[model samples]
Each structure stands twice: as structure tokens, then as C-alpha cells.
Target: MKKYSLFQFCLGFILILGCVTWGTAFQNREAFRIGEITVSPGEMKSGYLDVPEKGGIGSRIPFTVINGAKQGKTLALVAGIHAFEYPPILSLYKIKKMIDPAELSGTLILVHIANLHAFQKRIIYYNPYDWKNLNRVFPGDPEGSISERIAHVLKKEVIERSDYLIDLHCGDGNEALIPYLYWMVTGNEKLDQTTKKMALAFGIKHIIIDKSRTKDLSQSKYLGNTSVLLSTPAITTESGYLGRTDQKAVLRNVKGIMNVMKLFQMIEGNPQFTEEPVWIDHYEVVRSDHDGLFFPLTEMGYYAAKGEKIGYVTDYFGEVVQEFYAPFSGMILYIVNTPPANKGEPVYEIGRVKEK
Candidate 1:
């Protein structure tokens, strides 16, 4: 009776092992295909997503894809939407090199530079050819401006292909900002919750839950919001400032991305979340009324009361042309660090913190 029981136990163990092996093989057979490249499991591939120009010449958006040995979720890490946002771009470069396909469970798509035109020309927010901000245009028109065409390609190619996305950013050349994240709270309850979890997992000290409902599609064309509308959970992050590439800021972004990877089970280990992140429900952008030199009275991350002086616009003679005041009590999300300012340009972004 004892010999018979041992034989049965061995037979059961072999069957379980065979099932596990077959499952893994099935997952490996499911390849990640994009732009004429198909990456099988445990493989890493790098290429560019081509964007054609007016003269038939074209530019390419550099990308790297890592298909993990085990099947799980695909996470897309994108940066350099604005040319001057160096930290996030640098982090993506480092991350692509560090991640091993054998260790990852799913796939990671890394776009090192989204706006190659702006990046190469050292332009700030807008693309040089179209003079339009890439971030503001999404699901773009094929026959539109160069910027719009790039946006359309990204939406159809990169964004649509991913299960989740992390759009990384830093302050433009003329701005200083505190590190924070913007998580869109769409009407989709499940997606909103998942995005919130991803935001918290990013390990940022401040989080802004954007709950704005816009009738115009242009108003909601931001990359993060557009991704959410497409049924993908996404989050946008801000870290470095003044167009400077600080290693500390770059490392922070790298670590935060790794944490998100863990949260999605693409990698192992638990995410280290902030003990309590300051949550804000809404934010307002303070724009200058006159073209002049901007003199900020307050710093980034400083809390201000309603009607408090946040900054001022001065003429060439140093005379105050316009005094900017906070419209509501809130924390300073970002501020203009560049001395020069233009009419209708943003001076500061203030967020109303939610009370516990």
C-alpha cells in the first residue's frame, strides 16, 4: 500500500510540472509586434517610429521594447515630450539599459524622445516646425501640422499598444516646479482607482487629482487624459526644473518608474509609497497680462492665501507693470523662473490642497 501511494504522489507532481511548463511556453508564443518588429519572450528590441516630413524626409522617435520571459502587463514609459525636460528623458535612457528581459514578467516600451524636432533644436515647449505644443495635441490628424502628425503617430502606435503608460516630464527651460504627479480622475471608476494606485506608487510627495470635465476634446487632449479615455490607466509626472539634468532628479524618476513596474507585477517587490501625499483636487494657471520681465515674489511649493501676491510683471525700467495675486489659497505647483515673460503666458500654477 505504501509503494502504491508513493507512485501516485510522483505521478501527480510530474503532471503539475508539465502544466506549468506548457503555460510558460504558451505565453512566450504571444509576441509583441510594433513597427515591423516582433519581439518574442525573453527578447529585447530597439527601433524608431518614423514620422514623415513635408519634403518626404522624415524624423524618427527612438524606442526600446523588452518582452519579458513571463507574461504579465505591458507598461509604456515615455519622456521628452518637451525638449527641455531632461531628467525624465535621462531616466528613460538609463532604465532601458538597466532592465533585463529575463527578469521582467511582461513588456516595457521606452520612448527616449517623443519630440525629436524640439529636442534637437533645443526648443522649449513648442515644436519648431509647427510652433505647437505636442502635449496639447493627441489622436492628431494625419494631414495636419508636423507636431500634429507626430501626435497622431504616438497615439495610434505607442499609446494604443500599451496596457498602461507613464508620461514623464520636468519643468521647461523657463520654469521651476516642485516634483508632483497629475492623475486624471475620469468617470471610469475602475480606471480611476488603478491610476490613483499608480500615482501613489510613484512615491511623489504631492499628487493632483484632476477632476475637470471638459466639453471640448481639445481641452482634454493631454497625453495622460487621452490615454485614460482609451481605456488605459496612465499617470503624468513632473520632477526636475529649469531645464537642468540633475542626477538626483533623474534617479528619483528611475526609482519611481521601477516602483510602478512592481505595482503592475511586471517586476518583483512591493512599491514604496509616500506615507501621506498631499492631494489636490483642482489647479489654476496664473497668466501674465503684459509682456515684460517676471519677478516672482513666492517660490515653488509655497502655500499662499487668497489674494496674496505671488509674483509681478515689470517693465524694462523695473517698474511694476502688473502685480499677480493668487486667486485662491493653494500650494504653488510651478512658477516662471525665466526673467522674460509674454502676455497670456503662464506665471504660476497653483493647486488647491484637499483638507484631511
Candidate 2:
């Protein structure tokens, strides 16, 4: 009897080991098909560098790309493109880990930190010799400044290599955003429609038209014919000014990314979050007319009526210098708390969306 019992125990153990091995194989199969590997920093691909070498102030750029191709759509997610936006980077990191290679149907490419130099110093705005803002430099030149060179490589490697791009960002050093997405206006109806659909796929509550400038170099405005063919549907999102490793913000971003993956059918699971997104066709920049202490009466993400007193600009003596009001009834998407605002500096963004 004892011998028989021992024989049965050994057989059971063997079966369990076989099952575990098969499960591991299944999980890793997608990574194999998609090619899971690191494209070392400073590695040259085609004509652009994968990432820079790490050096004090100017070191190697560490960026990881995880490709999960299950024979579906390709989506590219980028974080830390701006050094100071920590929440988005953490969000992308968590999402990368959460993505199961076995369940994914399409390819997912993740670029952790696009701007490694500024990221090292935790600086929001990159200060290159000839330029101050890396975000403004689109389709950068290979022979330009340090920031431009990095941007140039990104345009070729990640931007041109995927079917869709989700550039994650956060509020600048001075302001906090109400988790929103900025869609570039290409003046093409088809493109605009495609962009809107993609934004909805992310399950974000608000969508804003980034018309603050004439063009955006990162996605559309800078893409030439060659870049255009490589470019896919893209959306730039601001995850508020939450610090890096902020669990709340990270979870929110992960949820948004998962929704998009589900929409693309990259994952077998159903989407866990949904929202009726508010699409703003236009936004007005309410700038400060005089430098003083600005006290905000209303909050970000709140609905404000036209001519409503959103806040007050005051002098050092605590006397009200000027009261800032909305020009039209819209939602307060973002606002600043820093005092002593110079004249013509943007104070708030009022958004007006088409009523559903």
C-alpha cells in the first residue's frame, strides 16, 4: 500500500509540472513572436540612435520597448518625454508590466523616457543651447542641439514604427492639470474623426483641441510624407501634475491605457472603466493682465458660467488689483496657483464642447 501511494504522488507531481511549463510557455509565446529585448542605450538603428548614453547632466538615455504582437493593431505608448512629468512615466511603467504577452493580440511599444537628459535632473523644460523647450521641436534634425537630436531619434524609432501613439505628459512645474487629452487639429476631417475615436477609446473624461500653436512637431504638424506614412492615430494626454509614483494617477492612466488596448482587441478581458467624454471644440486662454497674487474662486474641472468671477488678481498688500472672469460659459480645464503673474501670461483654459 505504501509503495502504491508513493507512485501516485510522483505521478501527480509530474502532471503539475507539465501544466506549469505549458502556462509559462503560453505567456512567453507572445513575447517571442513580438521579440522582447532591450535596444541598448546609444544603439544606432537605421540612422537614428535608440537611446543616449548615461552621463551626468548628459548621460545615456534609458528607454525600454515591449512589443506584444498577437496579430492585431500596433499601439505605441511613450512616457517621460518631458523629464518633470513623473506620474505619466510611472503610469506607463505599471501598464507595461500589467500587459500580458499571452493575452495581447497586437503589438505594444513602450518608450519610458524620451528626454533622458532632462529626466536625470528632473527638469520639466529641457534647456538645450539653442532651444528651451523640447516639446516644441518636432521632427528634429539629427545634427541639431542635444534635445533636437533626441527628438529626431524618437520620431524615427517610436513614432515612425507604430500604428498609434499615446504621448503621456503632465502639468508643467507651475500648474496642475485635470487629466485631459490634447488632439492635434490637422484640418482634415478624416484625421480629426479618427483622432476623436481614438481619444474615446482611452476612456478619458475630457478632450481638448491643442490649437495654442500653429502646429505640433511631435505627431502631425511636423510629419512629412515619409513620417506621415509611418505615423498612426496619436493622442497627447496630460495626467495632471501628480508626482512620479503617485499611485492614484498611475492607476488612472493604466486604466485609460487598458481601455484603449481593449478597444483595439489587444486584450481578451473587457474594459473596466467607461465615461461619456466631453469633447471641446474650442478653448480660450484667459491670461493675466497684471502681476499680482491670484486667488482662484473656482476649481479646475468645474463648470463655470460666462462672465463668472473665476478668480482675483491681487497685489502684495492683499488688495484686489483685478478680477479675472470667463468670457464664455465653459469648463475650467486648467488653472495656475502661482502669484505675481506677468501681463499676458495664461491663467486658465476655458473649454466649450458641442452638446451631445
Candidate 3:
């Protein structure tokens, strides 16, 4: 009788341990996350999906969407919207691993690499047919080519589904861009205020609040009145150039995105402010007048006075071909540091000060 009692006690203890283990496992299940999972622009039901186009061998597009524990605004983080841009996608990958969905109070959609076809082929975009730039084709066509179809689905499914958006990018091949964040101004007073606030929140220096003259309905403008008023504030990060990815720039961008999240109160933490960001509105593009071997005396982001010699162009024989000068008192926001230059090509972008 004593032996039977001991055996029963041991069995009871084992059962309790098993229940605790199972309970813990159930609590940790990833699906318990409040985030909804939907494959955009296609029916990709799992991570690392191979999307097949009509003509080419399909490419693999990997993505993950993590929602917060409590219901809140959905913020979409997308990279490789332009395929050749590597840093943003890498940053997205890092951001994905760092987030704990259980602690989130808002939805975070991460599209690490959007243009698989362009990425696989080492192309800047998926427009081999009409030679259209992919960035220009937003809110894409539903009944169009492969790129258009993909864009269409993205616009309808993802872009329309989010409260805020961030399109990450790097310089295309054959060009380099100084790290900067672009904020498009719609001339709307409220939006402009919100834009400035969001820009500061993101901690992006070298901000260009562009009041572009083009009236064509772009994705940013068109998406303003939908869910979240289709008026979601958007920003893009331009860092590094050509097929190269810089680790430092990537870190800067990652921190920048995190800063924005903190600003919006999506993340529970103190805001990281390493430096006071610089704000600039006037930008003047310096174009080359003739083809030559280009040589820059000064680097990008250097302040220069009006008519100051910034760089000089030379022929293959080392003879001075052309001398580039600052058009106004401003800082060289973006300079073509490449050794070669051609006529009518932009060499530097001078940020001139506007009289207040």
C-alpha cells in the first residue's frame, strides 16, 4: 500500500510538470500575435515565396508581418521597392529580428525585398519592356505587366492597408547619394506641420521638403484620403550609391527608423537623439557642361560660398577641361564624387539658403 501511494504521488507530480510545459509552449506560439498575415500582390502563404511572372523565371520574395499585442495603428516598413537597393532590405531584416511581437501595441509590416525579379537579375527595376522606372510607377496597374501587376497589388493591399509608410532606398547603379531623407510637401498646412514633426522624429538630417511642381498623382498624394485619410505621412531614405552597401549608413538608417517609431509612441523607450538634424529647403543641381574626366576638389556636404571653386574637370591628358563653382552661398548636399563626368550630367546639388 505504501509503494502504491508513492507511485501515485510521482505520477501526479509528472502530470503537473507536463501541464506547465504545455502551457508555456502554448503561450509562446507565434500565431498568438495579434498581427494579421496577408500576402500582398500575390498569394504567398508562407515566408520565402517564389513569385512567377509570365515571361521570366520567377524570383523569390521573402517578407514577414508582425502585429502588436494591442490594437493600434499599422505602420508598414518596406525596402527593395527598388530592387538594387540593398541596405534598406538588410535594415528591415535586422528590424524584424529585433522586434518582439508580444510587446507590440501597433502593427508593423515588413516587406524586406519587394522586387524579386529585379533583385535576382541584378537590375534596378522590373521594367525591361517599356524602360519605365519602377519608383515612378506607384499605385501600380492591376491589369498590366509583371511589374505593374505587382505594384497594383501592393497599392491596393499593403499601401492602402497601412496608417503610415516608409519606403527605403539606396542609389541606383552608376550613381552615389549622400545619406538624406526626402519629405514631399503637398502645400497643405496641416500636412506640412505633420511632415516637419515626423521628420524631426525620424532624426533625418539634410531634409528636403520638396514642393515639387508636378501635379501628377503619385502614390504619396493619392493614398492620402483612404484609410487613415489616405493622408499617411511617408519618407524615404537615400544612403550609399551604386551596388555598394555601407555598414555605417545602414546603422544610421536603422536608428533613424527607430527614432520615428519612438516619436509616434509605438515603442516604449526614450528617444535617441545623437545630433540635432540639419534642415534645408533650397537645392540647386550643378550640371556638367561637357564630357571629361571629372575631379572633385571638395566632398559632399561641405559648405561653400558663391562662385567658390568646388571642383574641376580634366581631359585624359590631365589638362583642365572645366572648373565647377558654387552658384550661391550654400552647402554641397550631394556631389558626384565619381572620377568621370559627361556634359549635361548633374555633378553636385548645392543647398542654397532662402531668405526668410
Top candidate by lDDT? 1
User: Which residue runs does candidate 2 get wrong by more than 4 Å?
Assistant: 1-60, 128-131, 185-190, 209-231, 242-245, 270-275, 288-294, 312-323, 340-345
Residue 153, candidate 3: Cα error in Å is 3.2
Candidate 1: where are CA atoms >4 Å away?
A: 1-20, 23-28, 55-57, 213-219
Q: Residue by residue across 1-48, what tens digits does model 1's lDDT show?
A: 345688889999999999999887865557898887888888999998
Judging by TM-score, tell me the better candidate of 2 and 3. 2
Write candidate 3's Cα lDDT for 122-183 as tens digits.
87644554444556565556555666555655666567767687777766554556677666
Error of 1 at 103 (Å): 1.3
lDDT at residue 350 of model 1 (Cα atoms): 98
The predicted structure with the larger TM-score, 1 or 3, is: 1
Better of 1 and 2 by TM-score: 1
Q: lDDT per residue, candidate 2, 1-356, as tens digits? A: 34568888999999999999877754654431222244322121112134343332233345545444345676778776677888887887687667665456767777777676666666655644344466756676666666666666767676766777788877766555687887765666776666666677766778876545444343333322123334466778777662445677677778888887876777876754436767787888788888777788888788898899999887778888888888888988877755656566667788997577
Worst lDDT run of 10 residues, candidate 3, spans 220-229
- Model 1, residue 132: distance off in Å is 0.2
Backbone atom clashes (below 3 Å) for every candidate: 0, 8, 8
Which lDDT values do the candidates have, in the order given? 0.88, 0.66, 0.65
